[model samples]
Target: MISQLFSGIAVLSLIVLLLILLLRRLKQPYFIAYIAAGILLGPHAFNIIHEPDVIKQAGEIGIIILMFSIGSEIDLEYLTRNFYKPLLITFVQILMSFICMYSIGAYLDWKITIILLTTFIISLSSSAIVFQYLARTGEIKSQLGMITCGVLLMQDILVIPMMLTLNFMSGNTVSMQQLIKVCAGGLLMILFLRGAITKRLFKIPMQKELTADHELQIFIGFSICFTMAWISGWFGLSTAFGAFAAGILIGHDKATHWLGESLIPFRVFFMSFFFLAVGLQLNINFFIENAATIILISFTVIFINSLINTILFKLAENSWRDSLYGGALLSQIGEFSFILMTMAAALKLVENYTYQITLAVITLTMLLTTIWLMIIQRLIYRLS
Candidate 1:
């Protein structure tokens, strides 16, 4: 078993390396390479790695770490000072998303729950992809980047209520206890953020002692991240939110800045797993069988989402160029939407066929996002 694991790792590394080299030459993002590696090694292809569950779990950890890194880098004061812009943008975007999805659902005689679910799914853009791109381009600290990050943070916070609504729609009784716990958890987080913003809440026990200790930095960083995640999960909140909060705390402390740097290698390694899992989850047969319909729906989703966000951002006082670029950045369906779909499926809110179609559409949109962004960039350049 150990030998097989080692062999699988070797093959996966080789394939991913080769693809990365190819994509580099083509001037494409590394994520494409990771996803391609997954597809090639997945069941539809060589099927070297038969178990996807392990990869998925590891990928989730990557997300948590990614959120933590983002949180650490976030200028909380900047976000709070300009919070209203993103709030307004996100609010209008969600409203428009719902209206648009509802009209289509009504026209097709589809159920209200399906419309709501679809709206929720499309309203969210891939935080992982957008953030990674922003960071790669050194724009993460730029004004537009901050605004985009704020909008994404708002969506993440809103996921709790979305989950509750889905539960109620699916006939699952959301117990009062659960609601109370969620509220309490939210309140606690608010307090924590408020305190962190106001002043230094506390300090790491051995800040000076741990500053130069490279080995201990890794363990300490992971502990802070996962411990916060565990706390957030206990409160019925998104674990990623917990990780982000942990990062904010770390960011507030100058002594612990090295923690973020220490975790970069881990983040890259684990994040590959997340993208790989996405590729593994792609049902090649189903996608091929419904290729035309899937492609149409995916493009429609990208177009509508991009339009809505662009209009909303413009209303928020951004220039048309930035708005269009931001919209393009957020056009793809997010990772969290997959979680929503799984929940909807388990509750039988959507048929298996619908679920598969949604999955394929989401994966395809993610795959196409980089190309879409490039197109948008060229268009903007030509227009300018």
Candidate 2:
């Protein structure tokens, strides 16, 4: 495993470097080339490695680090007002996603349980990927960009209970009483984490202390995230949701910048492993038999997702740019899908082979985001 680990690192680094050099001439998004390179080198190209479980473990830690960074970056006023539009978009998107995905599931004669879970899971879009790209490109300050970022934030908040509910409902050994117990237990933790107990920590003015104790703030912030994540997973909830909850609480605290900065070197190091691990999941045979299906589904999902986002933005009293914001950013699949797939596999809903197909397609889409956005913007500009 250690040998494979170093090998994976070497492979990813080489691929990333090549993408960097090529994109300069290709004049496209670097990530598109990243995924393309990953696909080529994956089981498809050289067959350098297998065993996705190793990389997935790396991703789990990446989630923890990602959450810590978010907590560190949290500005109190920005977050307080961040919930509304994104919340509205989440509500609107979820409803639409449910209707669309469930209908397809039913028409395909899928089981009710399968349809419900898949629809719910598939409707989700990744906020971490979306927000990072927007911020990196300096678009987060724009109106559409803010809305896009907010929508991503809102989705992060929303996916918590959504995942918890899905996990409990799908458990094969679960009974009615057990399901209720899971819900009650999960709710208790969420309330405790977000409630008065959690708020008191935030109330402490840590600005002065933070200047002197930035490392302490990072420690406390990361501790809270990991602790909350452990509890959520224990209660059959999504740990990622717990991580986000931790951020909301710590963001309210005074040492936000100190905490974020302290964790940066750590987060960046771990997240690269996470991305590489995901790249390792794209095996050759999985893509060979399922390439057509994966491509078709990915295109369909991204296309409709963009349209829905546009319409939602218009309804939000925003412009068609909303659609561009929503659609372009979401063209890729998120890290959350892996969690959903794991749970689904446990419940016998998704085949063992199935998760890789989705992962490959989504990863491809995510990498294409840079290219897709540039081209689509031009197309839209011309159409207008």
Candidate 3:
């Protein structure tokens, strides 16, 4: 079993390496390479990986850690000062998405539950992909980047209510206890953020001892991340949000700067797993069969989402060029949408065909985001 595990890792690494090289030559994001690698090794292709569920579960850890890293690096002060902008943007974006999806569903004679599910799914933009792009370009701390990050964070927080709504729609009784826990969790998080911002700086325990021990640093960092994730999950919230909260606390501490630095390798490695799982789930045959419809839906989603965000950013006083680019940055549907999709499926809110199509559409949007951003950038350049 160990030998087979080693062999699988070797093959996966080789394929990913080759794909990354090719994508590099084409000036594409590394995520594309990771997803391509998954498709190549997935059941639809070589069928080399037999345990996709295991891979996918592991990939979720990557998301949690990635959120932690983003949280830690975030300029909390800037986010706090401009909090209303993101709040407004996310609220309007969600409202627009609901209205748009409701209109489509009505025209198609679809159910309200389906419309709500679809609305929440498309309303979110992929934090992982957008952050990766910003980090790669060294714009993560820039004004636009901060604004984008704030919007994404707001979207993440809103997932809790989305989940509750879905459960209620599906005839599942959400206990009052759960609601109270969620409210309490949210209050605590708000207070924590407030304190962190007010304090501006703090120190982690055993700072000096942790400085010299690279091995301990990794374990300590992961502990902080996952412990917070556990707490948030217990409170009926997004685990990634919990991890992000932990990161914010750590970020404010000068002594814990090394924590973020120490986890960089782990973040990159696990994040690849997340994208790989996305690729593994892509049904090539299904996509080929419904090529026209899927392609149309994918393009439509990107277009509508970009338009809504662009309008909102412009209203928030951003220049047209930056607003357009910001909209493009958030054009793709987010990873959390997949969780919603899965839940909707389990609750029988959507048909299997609908589930598969949504999955394919989300994957396609993510895959196309880089290309979409490039086109937007060029257009802005010419117009400027």
Candidate 4:
């Protein structure tokens, strides 16, 4: 087993490296190469890597780190100063999506639980993917980028309630009272961390020591991220949420600069595997069999999200260009949607075939986000 694992790792590494080179040359998203590598190594192809459990565990850690990094970059002060616009837009988008999906679900005879889950899933966007694209295109500090970040941040916070609601609706023991308590605790922690702990954190002689031994600084950074992640799990929240909170607590600190630099290589390595794990789940046969249905559903979801969000942004007084770009950036389903769908499937709320089809549709929508955004931008420029 050890030999097999090592051999599989080696082959996968080589595939990622070569594809990275090709993707770089083509000026395409490098993450897609990681997914392609996973597909090649997956059961659908050569079946080189058999221990999916190991990859999944590693990928989970990768997600934690990714969220941590994203959290670190978010300046709470800046977000607060201009929160209302994005918040209102996000709320409007959610209300509109919920009504539309509920009506569709009723017509299609879907259960209330499924309808609610599907509504929230399509209503939120991928913060990771959207922010990454924005950063790559030098728009991370732009108006649309900030708006997108704010909306995604709100969506991340709402994930807690969404999960608890799912538990309640699925006949789990979770109650509204318990849900409110959990939310209150989470909010209190956020305030405490941002107010007290963050001030104390910067007072530590972190910068002096970090400047001397870089490896120690990296260890300390990981320690902070992991500790927060552990605390979040103890509070019945996702570890990624905890890591992100930790990042926000340390946002723009002198230590964060070095920590970000030190963590890049690890993030790259782990996140590549994370994307690969997503690819491994892509059953080509299933996707091909349901290609038309998957594409149609995916397209409809993206279209509605983009249209609604764009209109909301415009109503919020954003320029047409920025609003359009923001809409395109957030048109796809988020990573948390996969978690919700998986949980729903486990609880037998969603049928097996429907679950598979949904996964395929979500994956396809995510895969197309970059190209779709590119096309949207081109059309925007042409029309303008």
Q: What's the TM-score of every candidate structure?
A: 0.97, 0.79, 0.97, 0.94
Candidate 2 residue pairs in clash (backbone atoms < 3 Å): 32-367, 310-323
Put down candidate 2 lDDT per residue, 1-384, tens digits, no spaces.
Answer: 578768866876787788768887986644454445555556667766465566568667877778655544444355456557777887888788778877887788876666666555556676656666665777656666767766665665555556556666666344577557668756786577557334573343556776787667667766777987887667656676667667667656654546666777777656655666666667767777888888887777777777777778778777665566556776555767656666666766666666667676667666656667787788778868
In candidate 3, list every pair of residues with a backbone clash.
Answer: none
Off by over 4 Å in 2: 1-12, 21-47, 74-84, 102-114, 139-150, 153-200, 203-221, 352-356, 379-384
Runs of candidate 3 with Cα error greater than 4 angstroms are 196-202
In order, the Cα lDDT scores of the candidates are 0.92, 0.66, 0.91, 0.80
Q: Root-mean-square deviation of each candidate, in angstroms?
A: 1.3, 4.0, 1.5, 2.1
The order by descending TM-score is 1, 3, 4, 2
Instruction: Evaluate residue 246 in candidate 1 and report its C-alpha lDDT on the 0 to 100 scale.
Output: 92
Model 3, 186-238: lDDT tens digits are: 89877876775576544567889999999999998998899989998998889
Which candidate tops lDDT? 1
TM-score, cand. 1: 0.97
**What's model 3's overall lDDT?**
0.91
- Candidate 4 similarity to native, TM-score: 0.94
Which of the two candidates, 2 or 4, achieves a greater lDDT against the reference? 4
For every model in order, what is the number of clashing pairs? 0, 2, 0, 0
Which ranges in model 1 have alpha carbons more than 4 Å from their true place?
Answer: none
In candidate 4, the residue pairs with backbone N, CA or C atoms under 3 Å apart (3 or more residues apart, or in different chains) clash, namely none
In model 1, what are the clashing residue pairs, if there are any?
A: none
Candidate 1 lDDT over 162-263, as tens digits, reads 999999999899999999999999899889877865776856788888988999999999998999999999999999999999998889887788898899
